[model samples]
Target: MQLSLSDKFHSEMARLCPAPLPSVLAIMVSGGSDSLALMMLAHDWAAEMRQDPDNGPVTLIAITVDHGLRPESAAEAEGVAKIAHDLGVDHVTLQWKWDGVGNLQAAARAARYSLVQEWRRRKRPEIGAILVGHTRDDQAETFLMRLSRGSGVEGLSAMKALPLSHKAADAAGAAPVIRPILWASRADLRAALQARGMGWVDDPSNDNEDYLRVRTRKAMRDLAKIGLDVDTLTRTADHMARASVALWARAADVARDVVTEPYPGILRFDLTRLERIEEETQLRLLAHGVGCLTQAPYRPRLSSLEALAEAAYAGRGATLQGVQSFVQDDALILVRELRAVADYECPADGASAWDGRWRIKGRRLGEAVIRPLGAQSLAALELPKGLPKTAFQSYPALWAGQALVAVPYLAREGLCAPQYDPSAEFHRSILSH
Candidate 1:
């Protein structure tokens, strides 16, 4: 069954943005057929979606990232910009400045998303999501890349249709990224573009076999001879994505049942409940708990996590992934390592992210370093009522030029909340797979 361009476009947009579309949306156009096609389709789809009573007016814009790695990059960005202009959509070309280069692809991707996000924060804060053109071919390539690296199901799931964060910023707040065109094939997009009398610029780097993606692209052609084509790989990735979701759901359920925050910056999982779940889910639950405490972007390596799980299963204690874990009284206690936790500069007023785990807000606290209540602070001062001495060192405290001024969660002096929520962060991790 063949679907028209409009049909595919509308279906993708419907799945990605069902109702209540943002007042403004963005498409990343890299002068590629897939991205250009996405820009064209999204422009029309946004207009159509806006007509619904439940949805509002959507101003679609195109963004071109010029990495400046190659001489033709600027021209390619201009080419995309020209198309965006012809399509009656606003366009902006952002440049990536680099003094020296290593891992060009990764650097470019990070810079591109960072630039786009910065633009959104400055010009269109209403833009909640940015649409990226990641066709099925890209997904297949990603799957192969991860597979070659011995990745697990989560990694094999490849690029998801939506990610909570683009991983563009190290900070707690980052705009969501959506791959609305993942269901479409590159051929379909190019054919649609051709039908519309549109052309695209081919990046030379894509043909450079030195790159993993280029090599994988060529390898996929050979694999297609044996029926291991893009369709097959993409189907495998889709299945893995579903499996990943179920696994995450199970882990989240386990977390809800057993995980408890006995004190600020501390997570305790019931050993009985932890031992009951399957080993895989147990690892996931523990990893997620640690991730929430440390606010690290990625989980510990599966092998490392497995070792930690083994120790936990045996009622033993071990620390991994910036979290210190120990067993005490039928509970697996996990706390952020005071030595490992990064200190964040406290803000004067309003909310500021501390160690990417907690948000602190107060007045006249700017210039202070928010850190864990370490041995020195715990030894020198008195804690609030009902605060246990065992948990005293784990609490977050403000240190201003060696003066311990405030401990928010423990007292009325300041306000603090864990930035990472168990259920929310768990679902976010699944979505990003």
Candidate 2:
């Protein structure tokens, strides 16, 4: 006989928490079977504990994140909210929307957590835990996915039941995140929901073959046909998680030894110190340092990491996607911006040509020749004829044909006008430069 929904929830809670009931808990429900089952269990558990005099009434808040990737996403969010309301729980739906280029999954996850953190700050400043529904099957799938991608120990470790807090100290306070359902299998969650007569919406994207996760899931099914035990896979993931934690600790220590924050969004490393570390340690430390500085999960490709290592050891400069690291004055500076000198020089007086590369010629104050530089000029200029010299100088240079025909400085209203002080410092600076 299958366990009842309430029994299943109580058992899971006992296994995960094993302590006095928390005063408040937040459930992340996506209207999917896994999350909905978790929410139902939490609601039942909270109700049972309400009779105890020592435990106060549990504040259960259901949070749903809408990725907005599909047309039905808004409707799904509404459904989740209605379910939470029916269950006598408060609900919040966070929409992920932004206007820049970013990894879709990572960006959505960031936005979702941001909304959760905001809600925690406003309503439950002293929340005991924020619960997520990640099942053993999901853990197995994650491990297989990472394995196929040639991932390191960290990636192979997959998700953790109790992930460390990534929030700022001010925002997180003392609340901890918990995952009671990580030990539960997907089949068990489904069985619990069936016993409760609860239903959940199936996400259509789960079946889409175009996504890497879908592909990995398919591969996992094929492997299962060959008698791969799902439980064993989960066990392997747990083992890998332990190893990953150890490796990360060492990497953090190495990073702390070499990487120093001299300013906001900048890290400085001692090249000599880095050289003394093992090559693999050096690479991991460098990547970790960059990740912390950018607050970006910057997983540099193997080739890119190798290149950076070579550059660091050779005392050369190398540019990564959003960072540049180079040895300057015996210090390795990992900078986000690198200043480059402008190659072309500005022109002087009437018509001066410097290097066949560019030409700068000035015409009569009132009758200056303006032309565009190329098929695509730097800027388009429009000037009024017979303007004051100062006003002319304020006018922007206009692009005409293939030349910069009219510059504001030489215009009738410009500061360089013949009627004005022709020997003005501005003119002299322009000429000298």
Superposed model 1: Cα runs more than 4 Å off: 47-55, 99-102, 163-172, 271-276, 310-319, 327-330, 363-369, 381-394, 399-401, 411-433
User: For residues 1-433, what per-residue lDDT tens digits would candidate 2 score against the true structure?
Assistant: 9876567667767665545666778888899999998898888888887876766778898999888888999999999999899999889887776656776656776777777877787877766678988888888887887787887766777575553333322212435567777778888788878877888888887898877778877788778877666787888888887876676666566766676655323456778888887776677766664443333433676668789878877888777755667676556766442221112233334343222112334444344333312213322334333221121221223333334554433333242222211111111111110
lDDT of 1 at 286: 75
Error of 1 at 29 (Å): 1.4
Which 10-residue window of candidate 2 scores lowest in summed lDDT?
424-433
**Winning candidate number (lDDT):** 1
Question: What are the root-mean-square deviations of the candidates from the true structure over C-alphas?
Answer: 3.9, 16.5
Give the TM-score of each candidate.
Answer: 0.85, 0.65
* Model 1, position 399: C-alpha lDDT score: 62
The number of the candidate with the highest TM-score is 1
Q: What is the alpha-carbon lDDT of model 2 when measured against the actual structure?
A: 0.63
